[model samples]
Target: MEWLVPVLIVVALVVLIGIYLWATYNSLVQLNVRVDEAWSGITVQLTRRADLIPNLIETVKGYAAHEKAVFENVTRARAETLSAAGPGAAGIAEGHLQQALRSLFAVAEAYPQLQASHNFLQLQHAFVDTEDKVQAARRLYNGGVRDFNTKIKVFPNNMFARGLGFTEREFFEVADSGAVSAPPRVQF
Candidate 1:
């Protein structure tokens, strides 16, 4: 019965390996989903901010129609934010949007009437809220990326992660610190 024992041992090893692979694959799928959800959260916040921008621009435009360049810059940045495909691109777009918003706000600063408008004030508050949400969403996305990347890079998982279709996720970070050094001063 020595042959029977060796066969049983081989079967046991195969079963154990199969179990390991299954668990690892499932974990990776879960992490991938989490990261995607986190990214969606970021996108939602960004979209909210994008939607708020036009109203803000219109409000400012009523008071500062002469500031055509500022309005155009904000509009272009909003388009970039809307069209950005991935986290890296979105981060860069965010930098541009922030700078544009700052310039828009700077122009608004010259018009006390615009700053004091009820509509403008409400939009400003909404923009602030969206910015806060965007920051939170970015944190969640990057955290998920960090966890997923760690899982795929750890000893045994690393050997088969790529084969299983898991890959590293890009973190959302400002590509140019200088471009976004100062937060958009939305406050009057």
Candidate 2:
């Protein structure tokens, strides 16, 4: 019957659309998970660096007692990094923290005994290791953001993504070029 054929065609079309929608939703979910995981990686590195800051500050403080302003700056920056609400906020806070740390080490450089101390050298090595990890984690997070943003902005998927809760994610980046402009003046 002509009527029966038309009904079957309509049903087939509906089934196809349902399948497509399901696949798109799943893709979005997977991409969102990757973005979250990548962010966690960055946070882990941030936390590690935060944990190292106080010890570094104390080590330098013992030798550079007159540098109260530098110590205060580092302390405030550390708190900012810890309290930052998101990657965008954290990146800015981290840049300030790195600068404070540089000033701290720069002042420490004036003290020959402190620079040659076993404790100070060990701390510097640990800080350098954490900084490297942070760089790798940042790259991973940015890559995830790029993938997720592209998925939510492209055609077909974009058409349905907005209907869902899939929005573009912000990429994490350095707040200042100066943050990485100098290769960490680790000169003991």
Candidate 3:
């Protein structure tokens, strides 16, 4: 029975290793899904904000008909924000969009009547609410990425993560974090 003892020990070790791999793989997949959901949340908020832009631009345009450059810049930035693909691309697009929006708000400030219009006021509130949601979504996405990256990089999981087709996720970050983190200050 000497050979039998060695054979049982080998089988036990193999089974333990198999269990570890299974658990690790499942955890990685779950984390990946979470990250994807968080990203989708961010995109949904961004799209809502993008939809608000045209109305905002039109409202501003009604008052400041001569500010063609500001209108065009805002439109271009909105398009970039809509078409942005990944976290890195989205970050850059967000910076441009924020700058364009600041310029648009600056134009609005020059026209007190535009700032006082009922439609402009309502749209401004909606945009601010959507911007808040967008920031929250970005925080959620980055948090998910942090958890997912930690999972794949930890302990024995690191050895098998790559082989299992798991990799670290990128955090959603903007070029000007301060600008994006806060709602644009639209002074009335």
Candidate 4:
């Protein structure tokens, strides 16, 4: 009777440990999927922004033919961003694109005609809205990565995490502070 009680206690402990590990593994998987989904949201917004750039450039070109250098820079930046593969590479390319967009907007400000045009205004508004969404999605992705990475580093879970091929995710960082920071003043 004494041996039976000890054997049953051991069995119960083993089962509990098994269930705990299973739950941890599933939670990690869910977090990883969330990160991927959030990344997709960012990609969607980026594509929308990219699609709008051509139209914006065309409209600006019609009104500001003399601004060829600015237009070319925007085009080149957009192409580089679209071609970038991973998060790190994309972040660098995005910073360049953002700088170019800022220059383009600055040029537009000089031309009252372009600013007043309904199509140009609408496209600019849409691009701004898309940029906001992309930023939000990036935050969510980073949060998910943080959670997943933390889980995989904890004690018992870390053992199973390594065995399951789970690895930490790279953060999508902005390469340039100027790209994300407030616009610089151009006082006369």
Candidate 5:
């Protein structure tokens, strides 16, 4: 009877450990999936912005041919952003692209024709909307990363998290404070 009690206690402990591990693994998986979804949202916004850039450039090109430097900067920044690999790299590239786009828009302000053009106006609106969506996605992704990182860094979860090969995720950060420092100036 003494041996039976000890045996049952061992079985109960095993079951409890199994439950804990299962729950922890599932929680981590959900958090990772959320991060991925958030990244996808950002990617969608980026793709939309990329698609709008050429039209914007062309519209401005008609009236602002003398502004070759602005056009070239926007083109180069777009290319770099498209080629960026991960979240960190992409964020930096995106910041550069946004700054370049801002400069391009600033140049456009000097050309009344470019600013008045329907195509330019539409493209600008689209880009602004996409940027908003991208910012929102970044926030969501960072939030998910924060939660997941916290999970793996806490006491009991930390033990299992390390054992299960769960590692921390990097936050999606913008390198250019200028891109997000203030609201973009838009004029109708």
Candidate 6:
């Protein structure tokens, strides 16, 4: 009877450990998926904003025909932002796009008539809404990255995470907030 009790205890311990390992692995996998989904949300929002750029540029062009540099910069930035991959590259590309947009709008400031145009007004509202979504998506993405990073770095979970291929993620950030070359102030 004494031997039987010890044997059963050992088996219970082994089973408990197995269950714990399985649970931890599942949690890590779920978190990894969340991170990926969050990043996709950001990409979707950015693409939405990018799609709006052409119409905005054309509307501004009618009034600021001489602002060739601003138009080119916006166009180039939009392309770069669209092509950018990963958080690090995407964030830098987006910041450049933001600056370019700010300058474009600043140029728009000179044309009161353009600002008053129905098309311009509608585009402005759409851009603002998309930007808001982008900001929200960025926050959600960063949160997911933070969660995944934490899971892969912490005790016990880290051990399982390593074997499971879970790894830390980079947060999306503006590379140079204080850069003298500022993006245009994008909002109304």
Judged by whole-model lDDT over C-alpha atoms, candidate 3 comes out at 0.92
C-alpha local distance difference test of each model: 0.93, 0.88, 0.92, 0.83, 0.84, 0.87
Winner by lDDT:
1
Candidate 1 regions exceeding 4 Å error are none
Question: 1-188 in candidate 5: lDDT tens per residue?
Answer: 77999999999999999998899899999998988888788788787878788988888888879889989999998888888877889979978887888788788888887787888888878877887888888899899999999988998998878788889998888787778576456565
Q: Which stretches of candidate 6 lie over 4 Å from their true place?
A: 179-188
Task: State which candidate has the highest TM-score.
Answer: 1
Query: How should the candidates be ordered by TM-score, best one leading?
Result: 1, 3, 5, 2, 6, 4
TM-score of every model versus the real structure? 0.96, 0.93, 0.95, 0.90, 0.94, 0.92
Tens-digit lDDT track of model 3 for 1-188: 89999999999999999998998899899999999999999999999999999999999999999999999999999999999999999999999899899889999999989888999999989998998899899999999999999998889888889998998888888878766665467758
Cα misplacement distance, residue 23 of candidate 2 (Å): 1.3
Cα error, residue 18 of model 3, in Å, equals 0.6
lDDT of 4: 0.83
lDDT of 6 at 149: 91
Q: Could you give candidate 2's per-residue lDDT for residues 1-188 as a string of tens digits? A: 77999999999999999999998789889999999999999889989989998998898889888899999998999999888878889878878887887888789889999989999999999999998999999999899899888988888888889889888888886688688677458867
Candidate 3, residue 116: Cα displacement in angstroms equals 1.5
lDDT of 4 by residue, 1-188 (tens): 77999999999999999999889889999998988887787788778889889998998899899999999999999999888776788789888988898888888878887788888878877777777788888898888889989999989787779889899887788799678685321211
Clashing pairs in 4: none
State the lDDT at 112 in candidate 6: 81
Writing each residue's lDDT as its tens digit, candidate 6 over 20-119 gives 9888888888988998999999999999999999999999999989999999999999999999999999978987888888888999988889878999
By summed lDDT, which 10 consecutive residues of candidate 6 come out lowest?
Answer: 179-188
